[model samples]
Target chain A: MYRLKATFIKEFKLLSVDKTGITILFIMPVFLVFIMTLIQQQAYKSMSQSGVPVLLVNRDRDSLGTAVERGFSNFPVAQLTVDHGERYPNEDAIRKEITNGKYTVALYIPANATKILEQNVEEIMGRMFNKGQIANNTKVDIGIIIDPTANKPMVIAITSRLKQYLADVKTGVLFNIMGSKIAGMMHAEIKGGMPQEDIFSYKENYAFRDNRSSYQPDAVQHNIPAWAIFSIFFIVLPLGGGIINERSEGLFIRMRTLPGSYLSLLSGKLLAYFFIALIQFLLVILLGVYVLPLVGLPVLHIGSNIVPLVLLTVVLALAAVGYGLFIGTLFDTPQQSAVFGGISVLIMSALGGIWVPMNIMPEVMQKISSCSPLNWALRGYYELFIKGGGWPAIQTEVIKLSVFFIVCLAISYRIFQHKTNTN
Target chain B: MEGKACIKVRELSKQYKGSSYLAVNKLSFEIYEGEIFGLLGPNGAGKSTFLSMLSGLIKPTSGEAEIFDHKLTTDTELLKRIIGVVPQDIALYPTLSGRDNLLFIGRMYGLSEKELKDTVDKYLNRFGFEKNGSNAVKTYSGGMKRRINLIGGMLHNPKILLLDEPTVGMDVQARTSTMEFLNEVNEQTKMTIIYTSHDMEQANTFCDRVGIIDRGQILKLGTPDGLPASEGCKDLETLFLKLTGRKIRD
Candidate 1:
């Protein structure tokens, strides 16, 4: 116990003097969390939240054009711009606007669209009644010009939405023509031409498996946990480097002659590094909960209960410290451990969804992601923040992280023993 | 001063993995209690390998050795309490205070908190480090750093201390002071000291007896003053070069 305490004190003193190590352990993580969250928030706004801009040149000057113009105006999926009673721009101007990326889409409606639709419907009905050929003979093509530089997926989605809206507009115009013709033939009075109220509507909901209104994931929700897990795993840099420093400096030579197991010395150092890991974790969480909101990003929602999160953080710290001990024991030189530990953590972070979210990764990568210890830790955080889960939801991650800690520690001890024996 | 034999070795050998031959082969020697014994050798001469075997840092392939009835192989953990090793490198933590370094090492040797504090205080003054004990070791000079390194091993006060090139890199004054301090400690505690050095003259003057080894076997062993005359050399250095050869190992 004394040895452990001594080791802790020694590490604390050494770390206190190491400005670079302290910065990496504490300040860099907080800074990274803030920077990454802000960057991803902008990406989220551009990709998902903000509507695509669409410029409309409606030429019909009647109900069909007005309806089409109104359909896109202030739409959640698109922002529509249409000038009333203004000179219509030519195809060249519309193409130029789209080409310059002034708008993602430029739509044109032909002149007399309502009249053409009404004529087509009446002629088709009359032709059928007279036992003649029936067809949409009169042409009224709705033109769509798209920006070449626009994202293909976003353009495809917006275009698909535009097509559905146009089809509905055409159906409404045809229905109005048919209704008025029927009313005139029966000599009946029908107030209001083809009721403007929608016959059908769709409302999409964000739901849990139980269909509860689940919280939406923003950049803060995703990045905070990811960067937190990344920072925790980064403990290996200082921890492993410390061991290598001791060995290279000949401290290990003196230590080997001490009358106790190396674990006694290591436990204190592990606890010290674990303390640093906890601070790093808390800094990230605090930045997520407090600083991110101040920066105008969405507030990080850590669910209602923090008990499971706290438990998981402890276990995650252990896993990180264990991994650090293993790396430290395996390498003989500081430079070797630093390079390997730094690069390996980065790779783990990449695989663990720290750099990219798991849901966005390819199917094969998602499966491989589960193999990273950082992923296990991040999953626990996801349960707390995104899933709004308790202990049971994160039980698997907790178990996996715990087992990883044990395995790393066992390997570290065996390696340390082997080294001491070889010495 | 002569005393009863406290360290005994017979047919001790260590053949490291992948090595062609034994690093310490069929060695036999005994070190008496309270004697400053110097083990000398050039590079790759098995001095370190032999020291490692005696200190229980590494296992000997074939060996039977005893220190106060503690077997080298079987009672290694028990022997650790009785043995101390000071490496050639400056092992003290540079960022930590010299006092903190000693106290931590003392604690690792299972010294209680009060014992650690008291022993560290006493040793800092003994090594003339009290004035600079609170300062970080990195702030200390090379000699000061060397002093703290030496103090780290002595904090536990083991019965037998194995020093590998303890005074190799110090200036003349620092080296003289360090040797004088060790002599004072040896006279005061009657602790058996087994050290290695390239400084043949210092070893001749300080050590009661000396052994020059090469290729894992003892080439010569006798009292320091008696060794040179036995080899018809003017001094220990001349005799050492003659036995170990003039060719540079590096």
Candidate 2:
């Protein structure tokens, strides 16, 4: 028992100074969860989820700005709040409204934006007609400030709509320039600026394919648990490397000579790394519950039946640690452990529907996904999180993860015995 | 060399899996208490294998070895408590300071905190590591790392020390200092040591008895000077060359 404590202390000391390992364990999961949730929120947007509240801060009171105003007024996907800078004085008020979920996006058109766009467009027309016009360089940067918590599809929809309006106006001006030029060459008198034609605007039509009303695209519900599981499994990297180092550096030989069971020495590392894995899960879950709501996303709804959730996380972490130890003991070098362990984890993550939810996958692929431990883990969390389940619903996954943990440790110990502990 | 037998071996043979020859052939020897014994050999002469069996790191295939009548096969727990192993490799953790490494190894052998700290400090001072003891072993030079590795085995001060080329990579000054420190420990504590080395010059003055080994068997067993005198060679090096032949092992 004392020996085990000593080993644990030694491992903890080694880990404390390992800056790279600590960053990989903690920061990587947070980044993954945050980025994946923000980006994939668009996948949840449907026709029923349209008409997002939008604020237009138009300081450019010219032709281009009026075009933007007309575009937003007719925008099919937005509830346009056209303002004359009275209700909201500056960008900060718009940002406050966005954080409070009143508006999903704010369009800021800077002063003189119209003049720059018109000049650049005229230069483009001059270049097209081969008129020896003096070169002019000007740029128009229309700012789009989005709610950080807004889903990706919403931002893409708004930005692309604004871009189409600008392109249409540019084309209209180019055609008017061409008409005036042709009239001048033929020496014909033009009436009312080449008689501008009314161009019909085209709009995008979304096709609604499925009526799966049961599934809601909740960013916090999906990403927090998915990425948490992934980050937990990533514990394999450092743990496997630790095993290889012990074997190759003769630490195992010296350890075998010590008056203690191999399990005790093994426990020291598992306990330390297991703490890291648990902290990772907790951090991610906290971010989901608190941080998600501030950005106008749904807060993660982990029900009051907290025991099952904690139970599943512990078992998942155990499976990850066991897997790490098995990879370390089976391989001879850090390179072998890293390459094989890393590739296997990523493959498991893909098959487990970590990249895409298993429900949308082909039935055949979904069946194969059941073979991945990550899939089992993810399914367990989804049961408690999405289906409002408790111990009875998640028990099977718990048992499966427990079995995986046991088998890995057993095989690792057997390998260790065969390779080094001949006595 | 006159003392009670601390370790006894009889027909100890170890034929590794898928190998044509025994790594440590059927042989018999006794390592007495309070003496330094050297198993001098070339690269593959099974000196390491022999020390491994004595330390209970590996099992003998067809024979028995005992420490004071405690059998290696049936009594490993007791044997592990009685022996210290210094492997050819630097077995200490690289990221840990030398003092921490010693304290951790000492704890593994069931030593108390006070004993561990005091013994670690004494050995660190003795081995010329008074200043570098608090630094990580990774930052140390090769000779310095080897010193820490050697100290790791002796932290608990076991009854027998099994050293496998403990001074292989040390410089002249480091090697001499290490040998002198080890000799001082042996004189003051009466700890029996089984040291293995390929260099005859190293084991000549250090070991009280030298056993020239080749092909997993000991060819000559006597005092270093007596064995060379019997072979009519100038030293253990020439005598080993004459017995094992002039061919290089590796």
Candidate 3:
């Protein structure tokens, strides 16, 4: 225990005195989080106030196609612009416009859309009139052409609104036909052909509600945890470089002559780095929750389940420290460790959805993200913030992170032991 | 001051796993308590390798060594408590103050907080760096770093001190002070000092007994005064050149 304490104190003191290291580990993370949140907040505010640009290509000059275009125009958040096939000439030209980034999303109403709708409506009316049912065989496909590089949330919002509009139109038409048929039957049953006061009444109702308390999808909630985890893992570069420096300077060889095992030495260093990770995590959280809010950014929400948060932080720190130790032990020089550690963190962060949300990524990329420890940590944070999940909700992530920590630490210990013994 | 052997080597050998040549091969020797023993050799003469084996930094391939009746291979923990090793390089943390570095190393040796503070202060004063000890080691001169490195090893007050080229790359004044301080410590504390060096002149004047080594084997071992007479040379350097051949080792 004393040896571990000594090692920890030594490492902590050394790191604390390194101005560049401290800046990279702590200041840089907070700064990045602040910058990202500010930028995203501005972007979201602009999107809400100015609305997203959507191009409507109504090739079919029929009632159904006009209804679809009218639905898009009615949406308050969509800045609808209509291209009546005269400006773009054809479907290929419209697709090229979207691909060229002139518009974020373009909706193409196919030529037979009205014909299909009319057939379906006639079939429903025919069934109500005691006639044989008509088989509506025409397939109407509404082609939603979207720019692949557009902001994901904006594209999804536009697409979903368009789908909702189509569903509403179809349902309203069916309800009108059914209501007319029922009214006619009621009038026949009534003695005076249905009094004016007894006329049928129709209403449409829809609502959306969230049960989770204090739930707001803001940039702070996402960027805070994301950049924090990214920075925590980035400690690998400095920690590994420190170890390599010590080894090259012969301090490690001198340490072997001390009355302690290699495990004790490694434990001490790990303990110090773990605490550093914890401090960094807390500082970033505080910055997001308090500091950013003072500058008009949205406040970050922390869940009530503090235990899960602490556990996840510890496990993640262990994994990071273990990775650093492994790199330090495996590499012979500080330069090698720095290069490999830096590049590895960047790649892992990219794959882990730190730079982009996993849900927005392609299916294959999302699956690949699950293999990154950063992904596991981000998922845990998302559960706490977005899903309002408690301890039980993050058990899977916690277990996976713990397993990663153990595996990395074990491998690091073995390599360090081998290196120390051989030297 | 003759006494029971403080360190005993029994056919100790080390051949790196892939290397064809043995770094230290079938070497055997003993240094009595309170003796200043110098292991003299050229670069790559296995001087550092031999010192490393004694300090328990590396395992011997064929044989073993014992310090104060404790076998180095099996009783490393016990041996560590009694041996202070000063490596050939400046191993102290460059970012830390000299005092802090010493205190840290002292704690690793299990010194209490109070004892560590006092020991660090004492060493700083002894080395005449009390005023500048608080400065980071990176800011110190080469000689100052060497001094702090030596002080770090002996802070625990171990019975055996193993130094590998402790005074390398020092100016004449720095070398003289370091040698004098080492000699004074040996005489006052009756500490067994075993050092390896390439400077034959310092070895001749400072060590009570010297062993001349070459290619992993000790060519001659005796009192510095006696070895030259036996080799029919004017001095220890002449004797070394005569025995090891005048070829420069890379």
Global lDDT of each candidate: 0.84, 0.84, 0.85
Estimate, for each residue in B31-147, the C-alpha lDDT of model 2 and write its tens digit.
789899999888888988888777767778899988878998899888888888998988888888999888889988879999889999998998888988999989999999889
- Model 1 Cα lDDT, one tens digit per residue, A232-334: 8888988998887877767776777777766777788999998888888888888888888887888887887678888899999999999999999999887
What tens-digit string does per-residue lDDT give for candidate 3 at A12-70?
Answer: 88987999989988899888888888888888888877777788988777866787788
Error of 2 at A53 (Å): 15
State, as a TM-score between 0 and 1, how close model 2 is to the true structure: 0.75
Badly placed stretches (over 4 Å) of model 2 are A41-217, A290-298, A417-423
Candidates, ranked, TM-score:
1, 3, 2
Candidate 1 per-residue lDDT, tens place, B29-63, comes to: 89999999999999888999888888777888997
Off by over 4 Å in 3: A54-74, A80-149, A152-214, A360-365, A421-423
Q: Quick one: best lDDT, which candidate?
A: 3
lDDT value for model 2: 0.84
Better of 1 and 3 by lDDT: 3
Clashing pairs in 2: A42-A153
Model 2 chain B weakest lDDT span, ten residues long: B51-60
Cα misplacement distance, residue B85 of candidate 3 (Å): 0.8
Which portions of model 1 miss their true places by more than 4 Å?
A42-51, A76-80, A83-92, A110-157, A184-187, A199-217, A330-336, A411-423
